[model samples]
Target: MAHYRASESKREQFRRYLEKSGVLDTLTSILVALYEEPDKPNNALDFIKLHLGAAGPDPADVEALRTEISELQQKCEALTEENNELKNKLMQCEPAPEEKPAE
Candidate 1:
């Protein structure tokens, strides 16, 4: 019983270490990209080799920002369309009475 517990603990520790070692994040795509493009900007090691930190626009981060910008632009377009639709509906609706109601 104690032996199994010890083995389980060791396995758990190994699993955690493996996860931290990036078996979890699975950089397979990044590695493949690096293999395809040696000069590629955001390979796992490229950042460290280039001493990238506290500086602007890491390549990976820029790609993420571009994705975010695209999402925001879509949202803005959708909102604008919705706003125009609401305005058109408002224009079609009957207007409120100009005169005050009797007190």
Candidate 2:
């Protein structure tokens, strides 16, 4: 009997904590939005996880970012090659000055 009462008290405290934190309201709102979706998700848990940002970024956005990064990397490589080529040409054009012997 004592254990049962303690468990109930703990549950009530947890419920109050959830209410105070607004977690109950946020969860209710998300669930309500999911309920209203016309084309409901096959996996309700996945939908909730996605909405909660636990599923990472959208695939299309990730792909777009990857393409942009790849293009930038190529551009950077080309610029580096061009810079090295220019430096080599400059070095070839300007001969090193003769070193003087110590007196």
Candidate 3:
């Protein structure tokens, strides 16, 4: 049997949750709040610090995490859109088959 590293497992879990998290809104808010510093590393790190409730990360690690977050954001937007489309289709669908009167 093979084993996965703790970090790898955590990343997988993060990816799964991110797929469902609708992160674009949060990211957009962060970008808007920071206004003049959208790509400024400090701005992104500050937001991460607040939500993560942790001290600052190493610069290299923060850069990597930001990249991961960006990819996750894209995934989330796609999922959100797909989810809405599916929901609309479901709302338009007919009811399921009816059971027999006695059988």
Candidate 4:
């Protein structure tokens, strides 16, 4: 009975500390956002980590990176086509070497 009371007291103290530090409020807001999402995430902890900015870059940044990647891919394709065309043109312009009559 004494150990149970001590544990309860510790839990209450930790809760108070979280409230005092505004962590409770922040967590509440994140939870509310998670609750309101149309497609709820399968993992609550992962959702919370992403919302808290612990997972990685922001969504906007990710979108920008995706756009840049698409542009680079297009540019690479165009350059590859151009290189192939130039090689074909060079091959057509080159003549076969003449063979020597005697060694």
Candidate 5:
């Protein structure tokens, strides 16, 4: 009897924790949205995940960012080559330092 009472107490605490944390409310809202959809999604899990923002970023946004990164990488490579060439030219123009005679 004492063990059963302890289990019930733990369950109550967990339920209260969920209620206090707003998780219950968020879940209820998502379930309600799913319920209200007319043409229900084929995959209910995916729908819930999408609603909860766990499905990852939008594909179009990801593609756009990838394109931007590629362009920036190409530009960086060009600038690096130009800088190396300039450094080489500067080295050629500078005279070599003469070594001092050993004491």
Candidate 6:
């Protein structure tokens, strides 16, 4: 009775919100494109995700970035070691500070 009416009202409101936001149109267009394709993609889900811009970065691009990061990390480690060695040398060359006597 009243509960059924309330749920129906909520459903109508949600439908109107989806229509106003253009989500319905976007999804419809993507589905139409998929339906019209001459040679269907092997992975239909991937096709949809790719069309929706959620398929993530290209594999080649990701591999190149990983290689660059590894090279940079090695270079950073070498530079840190060199800096520590220089600091040790500087400390050895500099005389130690003397403590002042209390009156």
For every model shown, what is its TM-score relative to the native structure? 0.40, 0.69, 0.36, 0.51, 0.65, 0.61
- Runs in model 5 deviating more than 4 A are 58-64, 79-103
Q: Cα lDDT for residue 56, model 3? A: 60
lDDT, candidate 3, 9-62, per-residue tens: 888888778757966566666566667654656556766566555766678999
Candidate 5 C-alpha lDDT tens digits along 11-62: 9999999999999999999999999999999999999999999999889999
CA-lDDT, candidates in order: 0.76, 0.95, 0.76, 0.95, 0.97, 0.95
1-103 in candidate 1: lDDT tens per residue? 9999999999999989988898645555445545676575744575443443434567899999999999999999999999999999988896865997899
Residue runs of model 1 more than 4 Å from their true location after superposition: 1-55, 96-103
Question: Which candidate model has the greater lDDT, 3 or 6?
Answer: 6
Residue 37, candidate 2: alpha-carbon lDDT: 100
* Tens-place lDDT digits, model 4, residues 4-86: 99999999999999999999999999999999999999999999998888988778999999999999999999999999999
Clashing pairs in 2: none
Error of 5 at 88 (Å): 11
Instruction: Write down the RMSD of candidate 6 (Cα, Å).
Output: 5.5
Give the Cα error of residue 97 in candidate 1, in Å. Answer: 7.6
Model 4 misplaced stretches (Cα beyond 4 Å): 58-103
TM-score for candidate 4, residues paired by index: 0.51
Ten contiguous residues minimizing lDDT sum, candidate 5: 50-59
